[model samples]
Target: MNNELTFVSWNVNGLRACVTKGFLDHFHSYDADFFCLQEIKLQEGQIELDLGPEYKLFWNYAQKKGYSGTAIFTKHEPISVHYGIEDNEEPEGRIITLEYESFFLITVYTPNSKRDLSRLDYRLEWEQRFASYVTELKSKKAVIICGDLNVAHLDIDVKNAKSNIGNSGFTAEERACMSALQKQGFVDSFRHLYPELEDRFTWWSFMAKVRERNIGWRIDYFLVSEQLQNHIIEATIEDHVMGSDHCPVTLKLAIDVS
Candidate 1:
């Protein structure tokens, strides 16, 4: 039985591209039990990643080439695995669920709210359905969700809260959806550990100096069922490890993995 489980999640923007930008270097250095990724932007046989035989690979690719996608590299063999949140079955490769002895691990690349809010309605629908799906699984076993969630739920979660008001990631609707998830006995692992901390963010704009100046939004997350709260060793943002517009977030859990 394993005494601790370490998970790392990142929105790589594009996995194939990230390979040239220190992804492999950082990936090897972290050596997490489960390393989750979003926006792979590739399909089966499109690219080869040798994460070694020790790690089992799971990939979900978008119907449209070079679009949204997600993947997970896990060292421990899971009992079973699934793609998408049964009901959502999103065309854009989004969710990957791995069922383990102690918990269910899901990684998602949530749909973005277009600049013009054109996809906001669809995004809201997904939020509700996704939340419902995970909550349902939590009723049976602990659920650990990690990935680019695409919504910054609170004022403190965004660097420029006032300026970003009504913006896609900061909109009231998206925030409310996130609130509903938390209200249902799920915990935002990072915020649960570091409430009142400020300026800590996961995603940054590519606009000049935005990331350098640390002006960003905490859109990515690692949320776990409330019952796993005490098992958490720590939840953190690996902002210093760079490659994608968003940094990696890690969660360490003191749990059995037998």
Candidate 2:
């Protein structure tokens, strides 16, 4: 089968707040084939949403309430859906993997290293495990990995790069891990599609007037394995449409298997 699929990823900061702030409106407007989300911050009964009749919602909530979480809303059902990289150790709800007939979609909300870099070690471990997980998935089918990676890979990824060098998202070590992943044959879809574009960011700080100044980071991304790179028709930053501090990033691909 051959078809075109549109995928979108966004960090809503907090899903409940985003709903009140018009997230569902933006979601409908995008009308993507697959939708991925991060920072849901809820548990089983904390909140509920009427996602309508056409979509299926999958959620991975953090064991700790009002913390990290993720979700996927897909128009097409997957053969199987897995939460996190494993069964017993996935309490934070940081990752979800869906297996479609032709591809695997892995959505992640990478752990932030924190402003003081206290969680840097844990973040590093997560990256290693995540990279390994994706590599393993690639052995089966084409893969699309999307979510808040929590790092700015290049100097062009954020404003004031010089001053932000050692910051959690801009740290050299973090950037290197991202580079290593891309070198392992994953294409950062947006940058691969639109190299040299400037001031295009998906995430901005909530402090003060950062968004107005465009002092943001391109921490969110859509990455695909080499074989699927050619299938990508377009990758975009939906900066104009917003409900959270982070805007949506979408990938359009000429892909279908049915």
Candidate 3:
């Protein structure tokens, strides 16, 4: 039997809005074993998605209405599910973790620093806490983390790298945080496979039709523990299939959770 497992991660922007724009069509086409989503932008009871009975759904809703949120639909039931990082209260509902017998899967929507860099300090602090949380979990089992990390770790990740250096996603501080995380025994699946590839982005600006020009950033990612590096089968950016500003990123692994 094929032990390969397919995992799809997308920042839908708004799940309700994306659904009207053929989200369901693309969702079915992917047919992934695990479909993780970020920035769902809805509260509980606001939207009910019929992803079919084959997939079990888990959601982490924000305290604020129509704000940050995350969800995961998996074919295999998890041993346990966790919301947020550790015991801290996550008002924005940015994280969801599923624990299996072999591995732990986490999907997170990392906070954006904003255009004016007003929230940069808070975002940096959150990064440290997030790294700590995942590192602690890594001690127990292998980890697969996928999400819209809201930062372009390297110049190769952004189209206008020089001009956007001080910007929210490309700031030195944010890039350093990503580098630190990777140093802590994590490998960026896509970069590990194709380090020289460029102009391939997961997010784009809706204004000025920049996506047509391919002016975008690779903010979404799938990061696995260093131990799972050898099991990496494929990492792809589904840039053509999109209903939101961000497209889906997929990771194929040789190991099967079931």
Candidate 4:
């Protein structure tokens, strides 16, 4: 069996809408071992996807219709699958945890701070809870965390950084939360692999055709436990694959998923 495995995470904006925009084309082209998604904006029986039996599909839906949601399609069936962090009950369907032999895979669509920063306080609380939850998981086994973390950790993560300072995604508090997580025991896979690469972004605004100009933010990410750092081979952003406002971010690891 191949020792290396590729994983892909994308915030499809809305899976149903994205499918009309060529989601399946990109999904088949990548053929990753695990394909995780967020902002799926779906509920039960909303749509049917036939990815074939080789893959196991899991979905977490928000109680509200067409709102925050997530899903994971994996070729390997995990020992167990969990929705939400223990006892936290994230009813928005924002987190999915899968347990495998050597590691745990978690996909999260973190709550976004509203444009006016009205939700900033709630977002901060979530950041702490999520970081602590992942840390706890890391204590048991290596953890791979991915999806729209919704923060730009460094100035390099967003275009026109100077102008965007203190904005929702680039706020000092939000950035610090991400930094603290890395300082603990997790590594941002993309940044760790290409420390100085520039003009690399994941999410772009639909406003003003800015995506054509490559003006965007690298808010989506794949983070790995410190112990799994060396297992990373390629951490990449599929910026050209356009089916949503945010593109796919991939992590190629030298470790097996099962």
Candidate 5:
């Protein structure tokens, strides 16, 4: 009950590809209490992994094969778990909620609005539903929501904010949705820790040497309920350890639940 929990969330882009590209090595090295993954891109029985005996794996794959998916590997078994939002209408395997003794952990692979922002309206609706889901979980315990949110909430998050204002991840509307969530008593753990830092991005594009040049967006986040802010010891973007377009972001908390 006096344990300090370390949680890591990563958008692996495609889990099968990532597994071939040092995903297991990173997983063993980090040894996080809870490891959340997004964009798995595979259905059940698509891949086999031996994640060691200590950790338990929970998966939520999309009904459509080789599409959106999310998973969780936790050292501590959850009291209960849920897939997608409570509404159950959106069943793209985009959300996984784990109920622990002291906290509720939610890992999400937010819908991309696309380059032309054609899916902007749907993305906005998803954001609203996601916020409502988080609020509902907060009623039970402290909440930690993580993974690729697919939005750059501030100018400091992306390389060319002025030019990318209306672009998919950097649009004003998407940012507003994120802001609304934070305003509703949630803390962006990374931003709260390093308020003035810049150029620390999570998701990079595969085209045009974007990753090498570090021209990326910090669309991924580890957000917690306001009351749990005090428990946070550190929040980090593991940009160096990469296998996908998106690297992992970690949160360390000195929670002493008894």
Candidate 6:
């Protein structure tokens, strides 16, 4: 059996819409061991996916209709499944955690600060709670966190970092939160693997053909515990895969789930 495991994360924007745009084609092609998704923008019973018999699906749907949500499709059965953050009510249904023998895999669709930064305060508060929850989990076992984090963590993470400074996703406060998370023994898998790679991004604007110009932001990420750093084999941005505003980001690790 293959010892390596493959994982894929994407912000589908809207599951129903993405399906019509070839979501299944890309899904089948990747054949990832764990496929996590964010911004599903749908409630329970809203849609159904035929991902074959090998995958088990877990979803956390937002209370509000057609809004923020998350899901995980995994080939391996998890020891436990959790939704939201430790019993605190998450009306947005932004997080889902699957516990395996060696690690806890969490997929989160972080709240955006919005264009006017009106939600910036709330977003920061949410960040604190999220960080604390993950830190607690890390104390027990290694963790693999993946999804659209909503913030570009570094200057190199955005196409026009200087020009975008102070913008919602590129603000100093949001960036600091991401830095703090990394300081707590987590490694951004892609950046760790390709520190100097540029012009590579995951999310792009629909305006003025920004995506075609490669003017995008690396807000989606796969953050693994520092202990798993050496296990990372490959990390890539699947920019060519088209289904939503954000393309898929993939990670291949040398570790075995079995």
Each candidate: RMSD to true structure? Answer: 1.2, 1.1, 1.1, 1.2, 1.2, 1.1
Give the Cα RMSD of candidate 3: 1.1
For residue 235, give model 6's deviation from the true position in Å.
0.5
136-194: candidate 1 lDDT, tens digit per residue: 99999999999999999989999989999999888899899889999998899999999
Q: Could you give candidate 3's per-residue lDDT for residues 1-258 as a string of tens digits? A: 438999999999999999999999999999999999999999888887888989999999999888989999999999999999966689899999999877899999999999999999999999999999999999998999999999999899999899998999889999999999999999999999999999999999998979999999999999999989999999999999879999999999988695
Q: Write out the backbone clash pairs for model 5.
A: none
The true-structure Cα RMSD of candidate 6 reads 1.1
TM-score computed on alpha carbons, candidate 4: 0.98
State the lDDT at 93 in candidate 5.
Answer: 94
Estimate the lDDT of model 6.
Answer: 0.94
**After superposing candidate 4, which stretches have Cα over 4 Å from the reference?**
none
The lowest-lDDT stretch of 10 consecutive residues in candidate 3 is 83-92
**Stronger candidate by lDDT (1 vs 3):** 3
Q: Which structure among the candidates has the greatest lDDT?
A: 3
Compared with the true structure, what per-residue lDDT tens digits does model 5 show for residues 202-230? 98888998999999899999999998898
TM-score of each: 0.97, 0.97, 0.98, 0.98, 0.97, 0.98
Name the Cα RMSD for model 5. Answer: 1.2
Better structure of 1 and 4 per lDDT: 4
131: Cα error in model 6, Å: 0.5
The list of candidate 1 runs beyond 4 A from truth reads none
Global lDDT of each model? 0.91, 0.91, 0.94, 0.93, 0.90, 0.94
* Candidate achieving higher TM-score, 1 or 5: 1
